[model samples]
Target: MNISVNSLNMPLLECFGSETRVRMIELLSRQPMNIKELADALQLSSAIITKHIQKLEENGIVGTESISGTRGRRKVCYLIPDSIVLQLKAPEPPEEHGGSGYAVSIPVGQYERCSVKPTCGLASENGVIGMVDDPRYFSDPEHVKAKHLWFASGFIEYRIPNYLVGRQTVTSFSLSLELCSEAPGYNEHWPSDITFSLGDTVLGTWTCPGDFGSTPGVHTPKWWKLGTQHGLLKTVTVDERGTYLDGVRLSGLTSADLAIGPGRELLFRIACPDTAEHPGGVSLFGRHFGNYDQEIEVRIGYE
Candidate 1:
């Protein structure tokens, strides 16, 4: 399940107010279970459990599906959201300030295009979306809810929405996401050269140290296997001056090289170039499944 909200002013606060609901979220986050399973675990009456589940489902906090059962069918409940962000409206710039800016958060699985290869797959906080390494699974309608994705090689692309860029000069562009090297299982010392690009301009590459699974990720579900865990958070920024990786300058390429203009879409790409020395692999993380409790954040600063 995948959910994105522009704000969290009231409804969210109300949804989380109940202690029973909070416990329910905790249990469902680890694994999917039926209503009876939830009731038994919580030691609550069926009526009480049903009420809480209804409330949660109505609020988009939970999702349910029917599965085959001995008599007929059973409804299994699971968490729908990987994370929620409260984005305050950006204030209009004063005349003296020249222009205003805003930010957008894109879900990890909402890629506009992709070319994933073998040893690739997607999963939510609850369970795997489809068979691992099967490229056909990438087209599964349920992919929109993926919180973690990986591949031994290939690329994933996204088109960033150009919001209010026509009236102002885009001063800087930045993307914050969680990533790591990928291995057959888990390797602490493998290395991979991950490249980032904007449109046709190559921003430079960052060498991921290895696939991390020595310890459980901060937000990784308890039911997630020990070999497959979380990733490291990485932020890549591009401004008038140059491209940067976590603040350190990486290349001389600037915003102009990106050709940002009206009606021009920003094509962002993450790839493991075949010519690289390591070519270990790459993995991407989203809010609920990774250590960081945030989605792929794209910020556009205008001036």
Candidate 2:
């Protein structure tokens, strides 16, 4: 059966109050661990651990299981609930705005306004920035199958809805894009700098290394050129808190002061300066590739 939250009453919050319980929950979040493992890591006695586990199990916050050993004996331990549901008792109605979170893929094959005369480049899925192409690469999704490709800059623009006004706060937001080498016949640790902005406010900037290369990728076409390689420039966590490239935390952006409410819409703007000399661009993996898990999302919680 699917376990669910009973309510958001005082008692419910108390269960997560104790330090031991909090630590236990944190550990379980990584993966399931037996009682001995928990006890050893927490430096608590098995008996003490059992007491805490029993409380968690009673409230359906955790569960226990037994695994039979080769000798027929079994070991009993605890595990966290697979999913968590917060049952809010507020009187607010469900959000009814029209714009919802979405994911879109911009294949080399799909470009909004494209051309091949000057250089080869396609507009990102959302059509935020213009004129994106690299001379070292020419594998348009329109005709050729490409194993490797590159660009000067790749980005998407999103329209944040105006209805989530007072219901919640945009606790977290993120954007993901593919990055690769900028030149042909060149393969080494090439680094490029990228910048992002929200409206007119500069959010954060990152220096990306050219670790991706023409190494026979999964979605690449068979007729792709040999020296084509790429990597993903996934700026996953972007909020008032801070910005992160992939998983490593980068400086700039403060989540604390952001007013991610109903009236304000969000814009994700990215730029790779034309002067990066090594000048490589990005391939945006939207809902199609499933790298960052979200094209763009806003989260809000109410008690």
Candidate 3:
């Protein structure tokens, strides 16, 4: 159940306060039992067990029914909710890192626009979105739910949200993702020169060594026919100095070259153009399809 505070249902939260209460709930989960039975299992007095039962019943975590016994009618208690899930609030970002910044996760299937060649396809966590190697399927309405996507050539683009206001200015922009070369099945020797761009300005290109499939990805769906399994995690950062790929200098282009500002549109693109020297292909992995279990992560540092 959603542990939302807005519901004002504090009993459920309060019921788990005691170790004895939690143990009682565990016992009830196995099978319904009377107050005497619970006391015998927990080595607690009948009075204490009854008090715990009352708290659990008041919190809607348990239910009780009266049944005819040999001597007289006895109260049988059972668990109400089979399970409880606590959906706590997300933690706030720490106050550091050059005044903090904005960060977002872009799913593999939620691209704003794409143009890809054969050896292309998209899949959700459960199944493929459409026919593989058919670029037409990239525009399918269900593409938004894709957990894995791959292509032989062309590009896919997304617009990163820019939340800066007033005098706030960008210090640096970064994108991290799990990616590898795309092949028919899998080949560790394949290489691809994948390019990253911001709007029309080219950020840099990184050469992926291969399409990894030697072993199964940690989170790959079992339904797949065991093709490309995972990709290497790559991070690209652009600042006043220059562009860096995985912390190494990549290109001379700096932040000014990308024209980043307070209200600028952050059009980010991942491309495997046919003109590259190592145009093997491109395979992108999302949370449910890769070893890293993360989508395209974007972080912008600003003051």
Candidate 4:
């Protein structure tokens, strides 16, 4: 599971600050355990274990199930998520020259060009758009309604409208979307090297930790099957200083490298290169799917 917060304060600190809780999480990571099992493993009293487990459960970090035992049934505790990703928002820059620019939202499935392989498919909020692992469905007219798409390899490219070039001096370009690594089914440990490119300039690559599943995505449709759920929201940006992922600087490439011009289209591409170490795959989420509520958001900051 992925947890995103504006700050590292409050609930986060309260839940994970204790060394005992940290050790509890480590034990749960390996497998589920009963209260007795946990207390014995950690050498803690039942009361201490119970208290920590309660806190973890309240914060959505742990889950419990009742199973039959010698005395009817007992609760078994396990880690709800194999990993956690903290996405800290970038601090906004001070207002400069009345900051003027335009932003556009692109539907996730409305790509202008794509080269996807098997283990690919598209789905709408209501149901699957077509056959799974079929590339032809990607070109179907109904693709515009897709809230999710995935492939084992290849790329998807979109043409973003250059809305700030003539009217304003564009200083930065930011593209935000929900995505994750893709596995044949679902593998919590699968890693994939996902690359982003603006026109001819490579914006650096991010290794997606896994193809998330087991728990349904926050925004995923109820009709969608459990194992098919995938992706995490990510924001990629290119400003005067450099390119960044979720506010963290990734490369030295800057806005000057993009060379935005009048009547020119900004080509945005997401791909899993053939030479990548992981080469796992990719699953992109849209407004109707994934944990985030938005689609592909392209923002242009100007001066």
**Best-performing candidate as measured by lDDT:** 3
Models 1 onward score TM values of 0.67, 0.45, 0.67, 0.75
Model 3's lDDT to the true fold? 0.80
For model 3, residues 1-303, the per-residue Cα lDDT tens digits are: 224343454656878779999899889888888999999999999999999888776554665666799999998887644345453664245334335586788998889999999888998999988898899999999999999999999999988988777777777888888888998898766789999988888888888767876556768899877488877767788888988876678888776666566788888899999999999889999999876668998888776
How high is the lDDT of residue 142 in model 4?
A: 94
C-alpha lDDT values of all predictions: 0.77, 0.47, 0.80, 0.79
Off by over 4 Å in 2: 1-119, 123-150, 153-163, 184-186, 275-279, 283-303
- The residue-by-residue lDDT of candidate 4 on 1-303, one tens digit each, is 234555533564478889999988898888889998999998989888988887776454666656799988876887755456564565354343345766778999899899989789999898898899899999999998988999899999998976554455667888888888888777655789999998788998988867777557667888887364646657788899998887677988888777775667788999996678999888999987876777898877776
**RMSD in order of candidates:** 12.4, 14.4, 16.6, 5.7
lDDT tens readout by residue for model 1, 1-303? 112233533555567889988999999989988999999999998789988887776554566666799978887887644554433554333322324566778888888888888789998878889998898898889899998889888889888987643445577888888888888887755688999988788898888766766556667788877354666657788899998886678988887677676677788999996678989888898888755677898887776
Best by TM-score: 4
Ranking by lDDT, best first?
3, 4, 1, 2
Off by over 4 Å in 1: 1-99, 165-167
Compared with the true structure, what per-residue lDDT tens digits does model 2 show for residues 14-51? 66879999899888777767777889999999888878
Model 1 residue 205 distance off true place after TM-score fit, in angstroms? 0.3
